[model samples]
Each structure stands twice: as structure tokens, then as C-alpha cells.
Target chain A: MKKTLALATGLAAALGLGQAAAQVSDDVVKIGVLNDQSGLYADITGQGSVLAARMAAEDFGGSVLGKKIEIVFGDHQNKPDVGSNIARQWLDVDKVDAIADVPTSSVALAIQEITKTKNRVFLISGAASSDLTGKACSPTGFHWTYDTYMLANGTGGALVKAGGDSWFFLTSDYAFGHALERDTGAAVTAAKGKVVGQVRHPLNTSDFSSFLLQAQASKAKIIGLANAGGDTINSIKQAAEFGIVAGGQRLAGLLVFITDVHSLGLKTAQGLVVTESFYWDLNDETRAWSKNFMAKHGGKAPTMVHAGVYSAVKHYLTAIKEAGTDEAGKVAEKMRQMPVNDFMTKNGQIRQDGRVMRDAYLLQVKKPEESKGPWDYYKVLSTIPAKDAFRPIEQSECPLVKKS
Target chain B: MFELLGVPPQALFGQLLLGLINGAFYAMLSLGLAVIFGMLNVINFTHGAQYMMGAFCAWMLLKFLGLNYWFALILAPIIIGAFGILLERLFLRRLYNLDHLYGLLLTFGLSLIIEGVFRNQFGSTGQPYDNPLPGGQNLGFMFLPYYRAWVVVASLLVCLATWFVIERTRLGAYLRAATENPTLVQAFGINVPRMIMLTYGFGVGLAGLAGVLAAPIYQVSPLMGSNLIIIVFAVVVIGGMGSILGSVITGFALGVVEGLTKVFYPEASSTVIFVIMAIVLLVRPAGLFGQTR
Candidate 1:
């Protein structure tokens, strides 16, 4: 009887040790959706991105390897310091496996460095600077959605090809704007077009009358707005008021979003061509997913950033499941090896430089008479395939991409 | 194509007109700040939020009540002013006996609450206020929008009228006298507290009027005033926050200076005003028109 009792105690201890090991290997997967929650960029990637991320987790069966998935968010307020601090705290304290949907480029760059040091995944969706993949690419960072290169090649190249060649840029004086202007300028030049002039405005400028007048005086065929969010909306509205278009000069919103188009209304934003990676009305799959998002998001349609968050989160979970662990390096490797097929992208492949190569659309804002429901804002002009839409790998400056 | 200062005449004139419009707004807002600061001895940090409220009030009036721009012009200031009076009675009156910094802190907190509430409801995207006076005639040198021209003229009139009422009227004399010795004025049965309340209300009302005027030109957003208020404060600082006429003149002059900077060096336009403020502080700390305290 004493020997049998001792044997039972040994078996119980061994079983307990095995359960502890399993728990350590398959803990909860926590994702932090950090972006501008209360500032200018909030409209595009605020609570909506958080909701999309949650939906992605739910769609992924809510758990991976028996660990429940959790989504958390923070408001970076478009400040770099604030963002990096939150990222460090999330990584160190909360054990967040990934950070996603960082919008502003400066903040995104700051968080990217932190994620690199911690070996956590950084899913960039809202930010538009191509420098993420160019000079700042990280093994753990994935540039999932649109970037400045895509915008420049889509809107700038299309406009130049369509004879709206002479360009004047009203650039917001910052990293994002500078990258956008550089890329668009290159695209214009590549299309055999001339850039007449450009003026750089400070971020969050309330007035653009003086800048618009300068663009008008240049007599550029197109006024390329190298700004986004509120700046883009204000410049476009003032341009309309100043009769910039009526004076025979067109306005190209290089980084305009659907939110901006909604704010401007079709009456004023008409005839302006823009580029986007995902439009809610693009197809049946996008329509269904966006409708689901809108129902969860107070009838607000999902921007590309929100949609990209959903896709990135879903893809990240898939990678973790395939790798059978939450080890950042292993999951990132699996992510790179797998092709991204989702409602947001079809056969989207992650390049070595970390840019998600996917098709982009050049769209024109519909006129008021374009009969449709409230969210039907775009008329698709053209589609640039994934190969032609992004910067070529040979020209990449990212150290991660080796020379062929 | 005539050239002025290495820029085309059309561009230069257009920038000048734009500057004048901006100056008009500065003059109105700074004048309000001066009126409140002169009498109440509080910085009225809520001045910007009040200005934003005026614009939002105009927007709400149009959206909910189907009121036109003209009606909003008349009603928004009065409604916002009434709210200002209530605020003074409930909160600001208690801070009058405390340090000036307390008043500033209180109003700063109030401004945040007001701005936050609006942001929560509307988000940051600006709503368009249709141009009441649309289109413009092409001048020989530049195109002039009728709405912009109206704004310039109306703001000038409003500024001058505010100046006249404060510097020239009997009520103005009483208000100014109360500012000097509130206790003594109270002994004379002049009801100094009521005067202080009215002064604050009137000052915030001026901000409201400016908001109504600015609605068509700027997208009405929660941040509309916060963006412009910092510049107006600099205008007030440069003008010396002393005499009403001083703030008005300084506001217009600095606006022209900023516009000229944009034409010559577009990059410096944003900082030109602050640079002028530093120069003014060094040369004459009391401001161009301020009395030495």
C-alpha cells in the first residue's frame, strides 16, 4: 500500500509539470492596435481599426493552439514619443505579441524601432511613407497596406499620363509629405511630365489660401496635394473656393482617403482622382466584409487602414498557427513564406523588403448625379497590378533586401 | 505680367488679400481678448474654445433649425454670449479674488472640456459652411471672392465699433473706471460684478461673431479656434494687450507682414508671427500699444 501511494503522487506531479509546459508554450495572443485615437488621423484609424482587429480574432476561432486571442488599443495622438512609450509598456508589461495599424509615419517609425528590439511584429497600415520599406525596413515589420510609392505611381503617374502633367505640390512639411512629394515627383518625371513648382506648408495648417494662390500663379496643370487627413480636406475645399479648378488647374490629392472624400462631399470633391489599396465597394467580398464592419462601427464605412488591420491580424494569426508558436522570429518567417489571401488582398505576397505587393486602384470621385447610396463615393478608373503598383525590389534601399 | 518683389503682381495681390482676411480675424479675436483681459484681469484661455463654439453653434443652427447663414450670424453670438454669462456667474466669479493664474487655469480646463465634447460628437473632420456670398470678380491684378471681401469689411466695421463703444461711450467710461477700482466703483453703487460679467460675455460674443464670419471660409471643426488662437495670442502680445486701438492696428499690420513673408519665403510664414513677437518683447516688453503695468 505505501508503494502504490508513492507511485500515484509521482504520476500526479509529472502530469502537472506537463500541463505547466503546455500553458507556457501556448499563452494568450495579445495584439495592440496603437494609432491616433483622438487626433487628426483618428478618423481613418481610430476605434474602427480596433473593431476590425477584434473581428479578425473572432474569425480566427478566437484562439490559436488553445490560447485565447485578445485585442487592445491606445491613442498615440500622432506623437512619436507617446507611441514608443506605449509600445514599450505593451511589449514589456502586457506581453503583447503584435502592434498594428500605426498611422502617422513619425510615430510608426518610433514604434518600429521598439518592436525590432523586442522582436515583436509591427503591422503598419495607416502610415503612407514608403521609407518604412526603403531605409527602415525590419525583419519583424510588415508594410501591409498603402504607401507613398503606391500613391505616387497610381495617382501621379495616371494624372501625368492623362495630360495633367505640369505639377505644383502643396506639401505638408514633414517626413510623410516629403516622401510623398519625392515619390510623386519621380513618377511625374518618369511619365515625361514637368513639375512646375511646389510649396511646403506646416502640418495642421488651418488656411491654404496663400499656398493655393502660389500654386495658381505657377500655372501648373495639376496642384498635387502632398498632405492627408484634415490638411487634405482643407486644401481641397479652399482650392474649390479659390476657383483653382475653374481656372483650368486640376487638383490631385496624392494621399486622400474615403473619409476626406466624405467630408468634402461629391459636390466639391468631384473630378479629383485618387489612389487607394482597398475600397469598400470594390467587389462582393469587400462589400460583405465592409458591411459587417460598418454595422459594428456605427454605419461608418471602413477605410483601407481598417480593412488592412483586419487582414494583417488574420494573417498574423495564421502565421502563428502555422509556426505552432508565438515566437516572433518564427511567426515572421512563416508570414513571409505564406501568401496573403483575404478580403483585402488576393494573392498578396510579402516582399523581402516587407512591402505587401498587391493591386491598387485609381479612382475618381463621383459627381452628385452619380446615383448610388451614401457610401458609394468612387468610380474606378483603372487597376494597377501588384507588380507595377509598388517600388521594384532592385531599387530598394532596405538592408534586408540583398542585391541580386 | 507685372512683377512686384520678384513675384507676379497677381500672386502678390492675392496673398495680400489673403493676409488682410486673416488679419481681420486676428483683429476681432484679439479685441475680444483685450476687452476681457482689461476688465476682468483674467487671460480667458477659453477665448479660442468660445470662438470654436460660435462656429459650431452656427453649424448646429443651420443643421437642426434650418437657419440660414444670416440668422446664425445674429443668433450664435447671442446664444454663446448667454452661455458665457452663465459660466462667469457660476465659475469665474469665484476665481476673481484668487491669483490670476487660477483664472487662467480654470478657463484652460473649461476650454478642454468644450473642445473634447465637440470632438466626441463631430470628430475632427470639418463641416462645410456654404459660401453665403459665392463667386468673385476677376480684378485686373487678382481674383477677389465676394465672401472674403465681405469678411474683411465686416470685421473692420466690428472692430471699429467695439473700439468706439469701449473708448467713447458713457458705459465704456464706467466699465473702464470699474477696472481701476472695483471696490470703489461698488461703493458708488455701480454694480461692478455685473459689469465684469457683461464684459466677459461681450468679449466672448465678439469671438462668436468672428466665428460666424469665419464659418464660410474655414471648415467648421472643433480645432478651428485652437489653430488660430495661438497666432491671435501672439498678435495680442505684440499689440501689448493695452489699448483697444493698439490690438486692432497690430493685428492688421502683422497679418500683412505674414502675407508678405509667404510671398517672399513661403516656409517662414508660419514662424514669422512668433519671430515678430520675440523682437517686440526685446524692444518693448510692454507691447507696441500696452501701458506699462
Candidate 2:
């Protein structure tokens, strides 16, 4: 009996040393939330994302494999060089296990490369570029939020079906805007619709009178606003003053956040079609989670980017626990193997190309009267399934796909 | 029916008109800058923040006090200008005898602090203000929003009135004399210090009025003034600093030029104003209307 008890103790110690105790590097798991904290994209992703990441850590029992979870954040100021510098410091000096919630595509792409070289996980939630998963897919990068392709598929298809065929585009002149225009233009033309004209405006532009005049001259049935955050809000508000909608030209917001709707108020933003992967009022679970988030966030509801950060961090933590280590490649494999379930996501699956396959909803901005209360902005038009929502495997250009 | 270099005549005409509307803002903003410089011998770098404060004041009045747009139009400037008066007394009054650089540095730092504080209070996503003149008439050339037309007419009146006061009145003469000989003006019992304070307040009032007018066209955001302030400064430089009539004319002309660029190239619209400023500085240095000191 004494020999048996000693043998059991020795085996338990060996297993613990081999697995959980010895594998996690740095004695703690650190996540760096890098995004625009004081620029145009600030309200959309800023400190809300950091808070979401912290909430995720707390929800996951506050630690992984006996290592305390730490969330650190930095403001990228929507600049690529600034974002890359922060990412380098976080990975090399601070030993951050992952970086998440980078918004600007230029900045995210820059950080993606650096994080890949450093062998750290990149859980992108705020950026909209498809290239992160298309041609630039890294083994350690997981695009966990909506992308340009998903936006084009969901909102573009909805508008085409609603009898708004001929389109004009007001594109923000940047990587995300260009990709959205390109992908949506393809989707529009594929549906037997015509693109009449397109004008590229500089990012963070305040005035849209000139651009709106150009679109009004085009006489397209629909005007697609391929921009986000402050730029989107300004264009929409200016469009109303110019009577773009009253003149029978509908504005399609390819990407719109709840915060933007709140900023514009429901009166101006009504009747616009938008695509998003998550909304705070989607279901009971989302409501429970969002209420807590709202209380902590000064009564502001979380944008999809914020929700994605929370979900992705939670999943990353789970994957680390499951894989028994925070090794970038191994944990990434484990994350891809496990299906994601969260407050907003019901059936989320990560593909081999590092894209989070999730259902994006087709939504229409509710009229002021239709809104039941504050933060009640969208009414889901249709449920776009994960398979139909994301880029089909055959069309994927990522090298990770076997092409089978 | 005719096309000029790729753009149709109608489009060209429309864009030029739009340029004038934008120029209205430039004229009003630079007019204030010119007034402060001409009277106080200090470059008011805080003009942009003062403008932003004007818009925020309008927003606060409406959101907190239930005041309408028309009320904001008249009251916002007075309120913000009073705040500007406090700034002048508490800070700007100290650097009157120093080099111009000292004043510029002090004003520039104050502006950053003001902008940063506002940004912290309201996230970068701007708040929307209702349009007072929602209805518009479509001119034959393009869709002409009524607000745009009002902006042009209203600013022209304000500019003329301001120009008349500074260039054609007795008080204007006293102000000019004080700039040239403050001690003599003081011995004449004109209260030169009080005149300087009022001058700063008046200049800041103009910025606040421009902000109230702009609250609808642009979202009431902290960065709105900064975004357009650079262009207005270029207008001031191109018009020649401290020249009242020069600021007004150059403001409208540069605006028309910027509009034409938006129509033809679109990409260069933002840079077109700066390019003209550079060229003007290279050629005339004192500006198109400035007397070389």
C-alpha cells in the first residue's frame, strides 16, 4: 500500500510538470489590445476593447493553467508605424502572448507582419481588411471579426435584392475602403447590378458636400458609403442635409457601428442597410453581457469590434488551456479545432486560413418610432449563415488552404 | 452642355459655387485672426479652439438648456467670447511685451489643452446637430442646399460690416493709432489696455459665431476647427497677415480655387489651397495685399 501511494504521487508530479506547470512561458499570459484610442476610430474600439478583453479574462476565471492573465492596451493613433512600434515592444520586451483589436487596416497589416515574425498570436477584431486572411494570412494570425468580404456579401446582396441596382460609391481612400469597394463592386455586378461611378475621399474627411454632389450627379439608385466611424457619420449627416435620400438616392452603410447610430441619432440614420456580425440586443445572452458592459462603459454599448475582442480573447484563453501551452502555432491549431460559442456568436468556426467563420446579420436602421429605447438601433433583416456569409473556400487565395 | 477639360460646364459651375460656400467659413475665421493680429500685435493661435468651443457651447445649450438653433446662433458667440475674455485676462495679458514667438507658443499650448480636454469628454465620434434649414432648392447647375446659400450671404454681410468698422470708422482709427503709438494713445486717455482686451474679445466672438453657423453643416466635434484652421491660416498668410480686406478677398478666392480642384482632380482638393499659399509666399512674401514691413 505504501509503494502504491508513492508511485501515484510521482506520476502526478511528472504529468503536471510536463503539461500545465512547465509549458506556459513567462509565468503569466499577457494580451496587448492595440487600436485607435484617440483618433477617428477611437469611439468604435478604444478603451471599450481593453475593457472587453479584461472582461474576457475575468469570465475565463482570471487565469490560465495557474498563470495570471494580464491585459495591456496602447493607442495606435490610427498610424501604421505607431502601431508596429507598439506591437514590437509588446512582443519583444513585455512578452505579450497575443495582440488584438487593431482597427485601421494599414496599421493592422503592419502589426500583423511583426506579430507573425515574433511568433505571437494576433486576434484581429477591429480591422476590416480581407487581405489579413486572403493573401497575407499568417500561421499565428486569426481575423476574429467582420471583414470587407463579409460586409460586401451581406449588405451588398441585401441592397441589390431591395431593387437598388445602379450604385455610386463614396470610398474612403485607404486599404479597408478600397478592398470593400472592390469586393462589393464584384458582388454588385455579379447580381446583374451596375456600378455607375466611384469617388475616393481622404480618410477622416469632415466635409462631404463635394463628394455628395458628385454622387447626386451620378443619379444612381443607391450610394454605397465605404467608410467607417467619423467619416461614415459625417457623410450620412451631410447626405441628409443635401437631400440625397429625399431625392430618391438611398445610402448604403457598408459598415456601421451602434456608436455611430447613437451619434447620428435614429432620425438621420433611419432606413439605411448595414451589415454587422454582432449587435447588443441580439438575444437574451447578449443582453445579459451587454448590460454589464454598458454599466462599466459609461452607458455606451459595445460595438461589434468590442464584442469581437471579448469573444476572441475568451476563445484564445480557452484554446491555451486546452492546448496545455501558449505556443503560438499549437494554440492556433487548438483554437481552429474548437468551435466558438459566446453571447453574440452561436456557431462560430475558425477556418484554416485564420478567418473566424461566423454569421453576419443583415440589418436595417430602425425608424425613430420603431426603436424601443436608447441603444436600440438595428432590426435584423435576415440571418446570413456562416457558410453563406464568409468567402467560400474555392475563392480563397490564402496559401493555408489545400485547394481540395 | 459644353465640357471643360473632362468636366461639364454645369459641374464646373456647381463646384465653383460650392467653393465660395466653403470660402465663407474661411473668410469669417481668418477675419477674426486678422483682427486680433492687427489690433493686439499677437497671433491668436487659440482661435481654432475658441471656434470649437463655440460649437460645443451651442450643443450644450441645446442639450442642457433646451434652446433651439436660432437661440444658439445669437447666444453661442457671446458666451464663448466671454470665455475668451477670461483667457485673455488670465493668460494672454502677461505676454504682451514679449516677442511674438512667446505669445504664439502660449496660445498654441492653450489650444492643445482645450482640444485634448474636449476630446476626452466627448469621444472622437462627433455629435450631430439638427439642421436649421433642412429644405433646399436645386439650382439648374446642381442641388443647392439653402444652408449653403445662407452661409454665403450671411458671411458676406458679416465680412463687409467687420471691414467697415476696422477700415472706415473713428473707433477703428483709434485702434489703429494705438497699435502705432500705445503710449500716446494712453496719454490721450483712450484706455489702451481696455481697448486691447475688447479687441481680443471681439475677434474671439467672430470665431464663436462661425462655429455656431458651422454646427449643422459639420458635426459638432472637437477637431472640426483644427481641420479647417490650417486652411484658414493659409488664407491669412496668402491674404497677408493683419489685412482685413485681404483676408476677406483671399478667403473667397482660395475657396473657389479649392472647389475647382475638387471637381477636376478630386485628389488634390486638400493640397490645392496649401500649394497656392506656398506659391504666393514665394512670389509676394508679404501676401497679395500685405505691405512689406
Candidate 3:
């Protein structure tokens, strides 16, 4: 009887060793969060993005397939080379199965190239350039939320429809701004509107008096400021001071954030129409989620890019869970096939080309006098359906598609 | 047709005027940098941060002290200039014996710390300053805001005035002589150390003055001076370091070229000035107006 017991113990030990090896083979997933930590995109996706990924991991029970999930993060510094190098290290050495929240489009595009070659999943949440899923589309990449095309179509088209037919563009002279101007111009033209003229200003330009005067002289019905961040806020404010808005033309913000509008206040920003994918105070679920987010983010409301980070990280974890193994190809496939569910988005589906189809919102900044509370700055003018907010699948240049 | 990139007469002139406006700021900032470098032999990386601080100071003065644009126009520079003097006396003066690179590094670090603190406190969003000069005059081709025209004219006058002080005055002669032979100037009991400190303060004060003028036109933000300074550095290099009039001329010229690029290529607008800097470096390694010592 002693000999039989010893043999049984040895067999149990052998079985345990086999299980451990298999677990190592199938588990131990690593993910990377590479984003701008100290540059222009930092405010949108700095340490906050890392925190969101951690939150998602916690919500995922911190383990998948009986294997602990580890997330390593780095600052890409908003440079393409830096982003690609970090991606290479994460994929080759650290073996990160997926990368999330690459903010700058130039950096995001380089990372997409690396991920594609390595067969790793790359979810882009903060990049505003539409080329990510447009001409520069890659199989390994997913543009999770917001793009130039949607912004142009929503803000430009809506304003054009509202008899802002004659337009003057105060465009920033860069690839991003050029794309936005092109898309917005096309949208306005499609809506039977005329573009009077455009003045291209330098990025981060301080003075807009010359551009504003040019716009003023053009006498267009709408003065569309196709810029972002400080440039946008400055142009709009200067325009108001110059009496361009008060004189005749209306101000339309092609790309604006809750923070920018907040900083400008309703007096300067009021009556300006903008388009965004997410607003903190949209619905009961959003309000509740945003309350926590705002509290965590120091009472300032979440920007679209911030909300996108929250949603993309959550979806990525969900995909990893469903895939069982942390193989990039499998997880990406799962992400594409499955519907996305998160605080920022509900009933959202990832198209075959990896565009997250979600509703876009048209919002108007409220008058300061009309505000009931501190954070209540925007009034939702209309809800653009998911189908209308984004370009149709046929317009996409992505080669991979379902058999349908 | 002798036309520049198919641009109509009105459009070309309009871009030219626009370029002149941008060049005005570039010239002023570069002039200040040259003055500081001439006296202290240190590249003020903090110049950008200081310029940003100047804008923020003006904004704060308006918000907290109920100071209007006119008062800020006067007091902002004095306050910031005194701060510059303090910075130099306490910190920069200690580095005079070291390699010039050390001073650059220290200033760079200081800039990072200042920018970081401002970013942390105020967030990345910009605060607007109302235009002090309320109205604009309608030109034939374009409506010129009075404040913008004032910025160009004021910046030019300040640049010229600083050049006059440094190039023409007796105090300027002492400052120049001291830069040439510090020990000799010190032996003459001219108080060279105090003069150096005051020079730095004066240079930084120019940046602050530029900032105050800029507050109404530009959004007051921590990042306002960073990218602008890089271009100004390029402008300085292209104009030849230590050449006041060169900076003013090159600043305006590059601005016009950049404006023209916007009309023609558009994609190269941001990069045109850098390209010019590279070209100027190849043609004249010491810069178009710089002495090749």
C-alpha cells in the first residue's frame, strides 16, 4: 500500500507540472499603453490613459485564463520614431500583446506599421487624423473614437445647413489642419454651400488679427476656425474682440474640447456649434460615469479624447478576455467581431476596417447667464446617428472586408 | 505674368502684410536674445518660458489687480524684468566661469521646471486677453485691426530703440567694452558684474514686454513661447547672431516667405523657415549677417 501511494503522488506531481507549462503557454498576457506624456496631446492622454488601462485591468479581474495580465506604459513624446521604438521594445522584448491609446496621428501611423509587421493589436483612441482608417488603414489597427472627417462633417455640414453657406476658413497650416479643411470643404460643398476663401495660419500662432481681418473682409456668413488647442481658443476670442462675430459672421469651432469651451466661457464661446463623440452630461449613465471621472480628473470635465481613452482600454480588455489567449491576431479579430461596450459608448460596433461606429453629438455652448451650474456649459442641439456621423464603409480604402 | 505663384495682387500684398506682422514678433524676440547673449554669453532657454510668464503675469494682473491693458503694458515688464535680474544675480552669475553650454543647460532646466509648474497649476488650456485697442480700420483689400498694426509698429520701434541704446549710447559703449574685455573693464572700476546682471534683466525685460503686447493678441498659455522661440532661434541664426538690424530684416523676410509658402505650397508653411535656416547655414555658416569669429 505504501508503494502504490508513492506512485500516485509522483503522477499527481507530473500532472501539476504539465498544467503549469500549459498555463505559461496560454496565459501571461502583456499590454502596452504608449501615448504623449509631456507634449501637446498630454492633456488628453497622459498619465490618465495609463490609469484608465489599469482600471480596465482591475475590472477584468486582473487575470485572464488563470494568467495574470501585466500592463507596461511609456511616454512616446509625440514623436514618430520614439513611438515606433517603444512599440518595437514592447513587442519584441517585453512581448506586449496589444498597444492602446497612441494619441498623435503621425506617431499612431508609425506604430500601426510596427504592429502590423509584428502581428500585434493597436487600438488608436486619441489621434484626430482620419487617415488612420482612411488611406493609411492597416489590418492590425483600430481607430476607436473621433477623426477629422467626422468633425468636419458634423460641425461644417450642420452649420452649412443652417444657412452658413458662405464660409471663410481660418485654417492651421499642417497636415492635420489641411485634412480637416479638405474634408470640411467637401462637406460644405456637398451641402450646397460655397466656400468664400481660406487663410492658412501657422500652428500655435499667437496673433490671428490678420487672418480674422481677411475673414472679415471676405464677409462670409460663417468663419470656420479649423484649428485646435490654444490656437483655436485664441482665434475665436480675438475674433470676438475684433467684433467679427458681432458684426456679421458666426464662429464655428471645427474641433473643440469641453476644456477649451470652459476656458473661453459662454460669453466668448456661446452660439458656437461643435461636434463631438462624447459629452460628460449626455445621459444618466454618462452623467454618473462622468461624475466619477470629473472627480478623479479634478472637477474638470472629460474631453472627447479622454473619454475615448476610457472606452478603448475597456474594449481592449474585453476582447482579450473573449480571445482566451493573448495572441494579437486572435484578440484583434475578436475585437472586430464583437460589439464594443463601455461607459462612453453603448451599442457600438467595430466595423471590419476597425472604425468604431458610434453616434456623434451636435452641441451649442450655452450663455453664461443661462447656466444652472458650473459644469453645465453645453446644450445638445441634435443627435447625429452613427451611420451619418461617419463615412460609409464603401468610402474607406481598407482592403480587408467581410464576405457580405 | 510676373506673378508669385499665381497669387493675385491683392492676395500677395495681403500675405506680405501678414508676414510683416509675424516677423515683427520674431525680430523683437531675437533682438532680445542677441542682447542677452552679447552681454552674458548664455542662450536663454528660459526666454520662452519667461515670455510665457510675462503673458500669464499680465493676465493675472488683469484678473487679480484689475489692471487694464495699458497698465500691464507698463508694469508687466518692470515686474518680470526685476525677476530676471533676481534670477541672474542668484543663479546665472555663478555659471560665468563654466562652459557656455552649462549656462544653456541650466536655463533649459529652469524653463522645463517653470513650464511644468505652470502646466500643472493652470492646465493646458489657454486664457484669452481682450484686445486693448478696440476697433479696426478697413483697408481696401483687408480690414486691419488697430492692435495688430500697433504690434508690428511697436515691436519695430522697440527693436530699433534697443539697437540705438546698445550701439549708440555711452552706457552701451561700456557694456560693449566690458563684453570685449571684462577684466579690463573691471580694473577701470566700472562695476562690470552689476552691468552684466542689468543687461540680462534688460534682455529678459524685452521678452516680457513682447509678452505683454502679445497677451491681447495671443491666448495666454504655458506653451505660448516654446515653439515660437525655436523659430526665433532659427531667425537669429539666419540673421547672424549679434546683428540687431539683421534680425529685424531676416525676421520680416522669413515671415513673408512663409506667408508666400502658405499661398503656394501650404504644406511647407510650418517648415519653410527651418528650410531657410538650413540654406542660410550652408551659404554662410556664421549666418547672413553674423561675424565668423
Tell me the spans in candidate 3 whose CA falls farther than 4 Å from its real position. Answer: A1-28, A135-140, A167-175, A195-220, A241-243, B1-5, B283-285
Clashing pairs in 3: none
Which residue pairs of candidate 2 clash? none
Give the winner by DockQ. Answer: 2
lDDT tens per residue, model 3, B135-243:
8776765556788799999998898899899899999999999999999999999999999999999989989998998887777878888868898899988999877
Encode model 3's per-residue lDDT on A357-386: one tens digit a residue: 999999999988888997788899999888
**DockQ scores of all models, one per candidate:** 0.61, 0.66, 0.38
- Global lDDT of each model? 0.89, 0.90, 0.81
Chain A TM-score of candidate 2 vs. true chain A: 0.95
Instruction: Give the least accurate 10-residue stretch of model 2 chain B, judged by summed lDDT.
Output: B260-269
Q: Model 2 scores what on Cα lDDT?
A: 0.90
Docking class of 1: medium
Local accuracy of candidate 1 as per-residue lDDT tens digits, A95-144: 89899999989888888889999899999998989999999999999999
Task: Report the C-alpha lDDT of model 2 over B1-293, residue by residue, as the tens digit.
Answer: 66789787887788889889989999999999999998888988899999999999899999999998889989999998898889899999999999999999999999989998998898778788998898899888888889889999989999999999878999999999999999999999899988889889999999999999999988888888788888889999999999999999999998899877777777677888899989999999999998887
lDDT of 2 by residue, A1-404 (tens): 55743454355356573456468898679999999887788889999999999999999988777667899999998889888888988888999999999999989999888988888899999999899999888889999989999999899988898898999999988899998999999889988999999998888877788889999999999999999998899999999988889989999999999999988989999988899999989899989999999999989999999999999999999999889899998999999999999998877889988999999899889999999988889999998998988888788899988886
RMSD of each: 4.1, 3.8, 4.8
